[model samples]
Target chain A: MRDAFHDELNALNDRLMQMTNLVRSAISRATTALLDADLQLAESVISQDAEVNRLYAEIETSIYELMATQQPVAVDLRTAITALRMGADLERMGDLAEHVAKIARMRHPVSAIPVEVRDTIVEMGQIAERLVTKTGSCIATRDVDLAKELEDDDDAMDRLHRRLFRVLLSKDWPHGIEPAVDITLIGRYYERYADHAVRVARDVVYLVTGSREFDDSAS
Target chain B: MRDAFHDELNALNDRLMQMTNLVRSAISRATTALLDADLQLAESVISQDAEVNRLYAEIETSIYELMATQQPVAVDLRTAITALRMGADLERMGDLAEHVAKIARMRHPVSAIPVEVRDTIVEMGQIAERLVTKTGSCIATRDVDLAKELEDDDDAMDRLHRRLFRVLLSKDWPHGIEPAVDITLIGRYYERYADHAVRVARDVVYLVTGSREFDDSAS
Candidate 1:
């Protein structure tokens, strides 16, 4: 029974990793589509979202079954629960990618946003992808150190987001208010993507250390 | 044993409700602080955040104790897990309120943000407060219908967000990019607050229905 449980758990992790890869690619393509005005690429991101959604549904069902049948205890329970949360994060990332794609379709061509802003957003997207990749590794290997590194990487993304806004609010901002607003929203999406990645990293840390490190505040 | 287990679960729910009420007040006060640019009110929101954080830490510790001691199965485990998730959401809502307080400090005594825009944000804040309040009631009573209603309320907030963006992006946008960015980020904070409330509601739905109404792909 223990061996069977391990095998099933591995299978579940494999599915989560696959979903993570899809989310990462969707984000990448969506960013590229936004920069290049590739409506086809944007549409593809939109189309692929259903797959991510379907995978999440399947993963949730599998998780529920695993919990019911295997009755995971202690660390195994944490692992399963973390995967469930990670699945949710990945699915939401997919949704953000879809939103980016939809925006790309809406704007199309010459782009209301400036190239410099788009470049910064693309850079933020790369950072978000790295965060997701590190998080996936942390889960698959149960590496607490790798997860901690993702947390630090999130700081970098946060800095980029601040910089993005600074640029949006600069006097020389060329594309006017619409583009500034668009880029700022895009920056927020990237920032939120990184935030969710850090959340998954925190869960991974908790899974391995059995200690959650969130900051405490008084009510 | 079962009776004691149920009692403890109820206690946990009661504490979560308390945290929800605290978060609701934080948002409301944060809104007042923003509208009035009252340093006293902003300081209050900032000071009150520690309380929310402490409550979250306490609840998390209590949850760990319950899991370690009770070894709850199935639905009971789900309840503990949902509590953990909801605690995180409330903590985030508090953080967002604090963010608004910071905004108040940065743009005090007369925000460049237009009166109309400020009113729209205040409305969004009110909606977020209602979402949390309804969420508290739904979780305490396990009212799935009330949970669904909160989901509908999120849809209304989304509409408000879109309208806010439309006005900011219109040809006659007067406050320039800085105020527009401020408005967008604040809208995002409220939107995310609503999103987490919907997440808590979905958890309630899952707890009661054994099937999730909203997954990660949900808006």
Candidate 2:
């Protein structure tokens, strides 16, 4: 029974890893769709979100089932609970990616991001991709250090997000209200994507340390 | 032992109710702060969010403890898990309200919503308040019907959100990028707040029905 419980836990971890990969690909593809105005890629990313949601639901149900049957205590209990929270964060990250893709698809032939701020958006996307990749590793290996490092990536994403805001607020910004709204919302999507990644990492920290300190800081 | 478990469950429900009330007030105050440019109210809302977070943590810890010790099954188990998810959604709703308040504080001495879109924002805020109020009742009574009605409020919010965009994109948009961005984000904050309420209501639906259909629809 103990071995079976451990196997279920391992399966849960694998499912979470799969979710992280799906979210990573969604954000990456969504960014490409946004920058290149590729409706096909955008649609693909949007539709693929169902898969991420499915994985999230499956992992969440499994966690609950594990808890109900195994009645894990101490670290094992913490692991199951934290896995549920991390699944939620990852699912939200995927939703953010889908939001970006929807914006890209809505704009169709025209890029959602104006050319002047495109580079910053690209940089934010890169940071988000890197953060999720590291977060996936952190979850799989329970690497507290790697989880801690995601904060730095999140900081980089924040700086890029601020840069996008500065450009929009600049007197020289000529894109007017439509593109400005698009850029602001799109920037927010990327910013929130990184935030969720950081949140997942923080959940990993909590699972390891059993401390609410990291979770508190993320808020 | 069963009585003790019931007492604990009641305490969990009370904490959730308290959280709902706190989040409701936060959104109300945040909306006022944004519309009136009241920095004091915005600061009050922002600072009060800590209480909401504390309640969230307390409720979450209690739920986990209940599950671990009680080993609740069937309806009881579903209730416990659903409470956890509902607490999370309510906490996020509080955070969204805080985000709105922060925007209000950041834009102090100036209204965030331009005059053209001010009424629409006001309407959105009202819809959010109503939905949350119903959501609170739904949580307390397990009123699946009331929970289902939140979707209508969400639809109303979506329409208002779309209206804000139309105003921003209109040729008559007098305000430049700065105010436009502010209005856009503020609209989103309210929209997301309502979405979280609907999510909480949906959790209640799932707890009662043991079905994932509504949950899938919301996502």
Candidate 3:
């Protein structure tokens, strides 16, 4: 019985890592779709988010069942519960990626980058990919040190997010309100994506330390 | 043992309701601060968010303790875990309110909202409050009917959200890019607040029904 419970726990860990990989691909494709105006890639990201959601649904069901039947306690209990949160965070990351894709779809054949802020979007996208990739490693390995380092990546994302605003708010901005609005929303999506990744990393820390260190005003 | 576990559950329920009320007020004051450029109200909302966070922490601690010691099963287990999720949703609603308040503070002595979109914001704020109030009731009463009704309010919020975009994108929009960005983010904060409120209600539904109805593309 104990072996079966540990096996279920290991299975849960595998599924979460799989989800991390999916969302990683998601943000990666989403950024490309936005920068290149690739409708097909955007469509792929948008439609494939259901796969991420389906994985989360399975994780939740497994956790619920594990708790109901096996009644895991202590470290095993913490691991099971934290997986549920990490899954939700990853699921939200998927949604944020899809949101970026929808923006790409909305501006199809007409890139939303606007050149002045294109580099910032590119860097933000890269940082988002890096953060989620590390987050997956942290979850699978339970590396608290790796999890702690996500804040630095998050800080980089924040810098780009602010730079995005600076570019938009500049007097020389000639894209008018439409692109500014698109960029604002887009910038928010990337920043939120980064935050959720950090949150998943944070959950890994919580799983290890049994304490949740909530960030101050992630928005 | 079961009775003590249930007593703990009841305490958790009360704390969640209290959190809902705090977030309800947070959104209310945040809206007033944004509309009226009342820095004091905005500051109040901003500072008081810590209270919401503290409450969430306490609830989390209690839930973790209950789970470790009690090992609740079946419905009792479901109630304990669901409380954790509902607490998280309410905590996020508090943060969303603070984001709105920060926007107000950033534009202090100068309203972030323009005259044209002012009414829309007012209505959005009112609906945010209504959604949260009903969310609190849903937590307390477990009334699935009231839980279902939050969808209509959410739909109304989504409609107003679209209306906001229309006004921002309108050719007659005179506010330029800065206010448009502010309005875009503020609209998103309200929309997300409504979404989170709906999620809490959905958790209530899940509590009673044991199945999660994942919404399609809330953003």
Candidate 4:
């Protein structure tokens, strides 16, 4: 029974890592689609999110079954619970990627990102990809140090998010209200995507340490 | 043992209801702050979010203790898991409300909402309040029917969210990029809040029936 429960936990970890990979690819493609107005890439991101959701649904079912059958306690219990949360955050990361793709699709034949903000969007996308990559590593390795590093990536994403806004709110922002609205929502999507990645990493930390990061700080 | 587990579940439900009320008030005051440019009200919303967070942290601790010590199975298990998920959604709702309040605070003495889009925001805020109110009741009563009704409120919120974008995109929109950006984000915050409420409702349904709504649809 113990070995079987451990196997189930390993399977849950593998599923969560798969989710991270999919979300990473989704955001990477979403950024390209936005920058180049590649409707095909955008469409692919939007459509392929179903696979991410399918994985998430599978993870949910498996976790429920594992808890129902195994009744894991202590560290194993934390593993199951945090896996559920990590799956949720990764699932949301997928949605955020799709949201970015939808914006690209919406403005097909014309790039949604203004030329001035192009570099920032590129950087945000890279940060998002980087964060998710590290998140996957943390999940797979249970490396607490790597999980802590995710906060730095998150901070960098926030900096770029603010920069995107500054460009929008600049006096010479020539794109007017339409692009402003698009950029505002797009920037928010990337920032939120980064946030979910960080959250998943935090769960990894919690699962490994058996202590929530915030609680550690408070104590 | 079963009676004690159920007692803990009941306490979790009561905490969730309390969270719902806190978030509902937060959104209500956030809307009023944005519309009236009421600095005091926005400040209150911003500051009071800590209380919501406190309650959520308490609930998390309780749920973790419940799961760890009891290893509840079946319906008791679902209730504990869903309580954690619902607590998370409600905590996010609190953050969304605080986002609105921060916008209000930023634009103090000058309304962040333009006169043209004011009605839509008012309606959005009202729907948010109503959805969360139903969410509270759904958690309290585990009423699947009441939980289903939240989808209608969510639809109403979606309609208003689009209406907000329409007014912003219209050719005659007098506001420039700043207010437009604010409105776009505020609209999204409210829309996402409603989505979270619907999710909580869905969780309520799942806890009651031991079946996911989407699973039922798929079958």
Question: DockQ for each candidate?
Answer: 0.48, 0.64, 0.87, 0.61
State iRMS for model 4. Answer: 4.8
lDDT of 4: 0.90
Query: Where does model 3 exceed 4 Å of error?
Result: A213-217, B213-217
Q: What lDDT does each candidate get?
A: 0.80, 0.88, 0.93, 0.90
> Judged by TM-score, which candidate is best?
3
Off by over 4 Å in 4: A214-219, B214-219
Highest DockQ against the true fold, candidate: 3
Number of the top candidate by lDDT? Answer: 3
True contacts kept of each: 0.50, 0.62, 0.93, 0.81
For model 2, how does the per-residue alpha-carbon lDDT over B80-191 read when each residue is reduced to its tens digit?
A: 8788888988998999999999999998898887789989989998998999999999889999888888888999999999999999999988888898988888888888
Give a tens-digit lDDT track for model 1, residues B66-151: 76666677888778877887887788888988888877777888753577687788789889889999988988889888888986
The candidate 1 chain B region of ten consecutive residues with least summed lDDT is B210-219
Q: Tens digit of lDDT per residue, candidate 1, span A1-74? A: 77888898888788888888898898889888888888999999999999999988888778777766777777
Weakest lDDT window of 10 consecutive positions for candidate 4 chain A: A210-219
Q: Write the per-residue lDDT of candidate 3 for residues B1-219, one digit (tens) a residue.
A: 888998989999999999999999999999999999999999999999999999998998899899999999999889998999989999999999999999999999999999999999999999999999999999889999999999999999999999999999999999899999999999999999999999999989989988665445355
Query: In model 2, what is the error at residue A58, expressed in angstroms?
Result: 1.6
Off by over 4 Å in 2: A217-219, B217-219
lDDT of 4 by residue, B1-219 (tens): 878988988888888999999999999999999999999999999999998889988998898899999999888888898899999999999999999999999999999988899999999999999999999998888899998888889889988999999999999999899999999999999999998889988998898888785432110
* TM-score computed on alpha carbons, candidate 1: 0.92
